[model samples]
Target: MEERTDMPSDPTAVDPYGCGCTECLTGEYIPLERATEVHIADMLAGRLRNHTGTTFHLTADYTIEPNTTLPELTPERLTITCPDHELTWTLATPRHRPLEDHHRAGPSLEYSDGSARVVPRHRLPS
Candidate 1:
């Protein structure tokens, strides 16, 4: 008699790119560059709201100074942790073109902390 072992057979489980996982559930196309922008915007907004008691509206064209150091996006989702606030945010790239880009470009987001992420536009939900 031969002993048999059970193995997981999900494609997402075996995916090398880290797509098809729960972390990447959105299945959106977000490039690395774009995702970072979102994260920075969110962090700045939170800080302003918390410390100054004022709400700041974020625009896509917001500029991130070249001196700022942020995390790089991976094939899987990006997680950013803010040391000051101890907040963690998971960013998913937009699958479609950003509304401001005439629906032809992907968008990215950044969370609190110094982490940033981007997903390509084509990966977004149709």
Candidate 2:
């Protein structure tokens, strides 16, 4: 069965982005940078755990420096725990581009099928 709630008079009021509608008194929106970070981290960790459980850690280091980048498709400092080693990996400044962009560029990680997978350096073409 499907249930439906009446649409609010000011639809933006219920929107998390809070488009300045009259009823949007305190709606909050997730900045692009933060959203990108969370999405990447969650998807990456899940895929690592599934494919490389021996090396992936659920509590591995994951952080986003809000002060370093604007909420756009720009590079931001990112550090992620390696899946097959005892060391951490640093993207230095991972751009907030779509997962496809990163995958195509052949970074240390790739995102696809709603998950992020690791791509080894050796896999890259000369």
Worst 10 residues of 1 by lDDT: 9-18
What are the root-mean-square deviations of the candidates from the true structure over C-alphas?
15.2, 16.8
Q: Candidate 1 residues 1-126, lDDT tens each? A: 864344322111111122344423432222222223353444443321122122333223222346532222123444444443334445543333333443355443434354454533344676
Clashing pairs in 2: none
lDDT of 2 by residue, 21-97 (tens): 43333223222122233334434544222222234333312345666432223334455554544434343333444
| Model 1 score (lDDT) | 0.35
Provide the global lDDT of candidate 2 against the true structure: 0.37
The C-alpha lDDT values of all candidates are 0.35, 0.37
For residue 63, model 1's alpha carbon misses the true position, in angstroms, by 30
TM-score of each: 0.22, 0.21
lDDT at position 63, candidate 2: 42
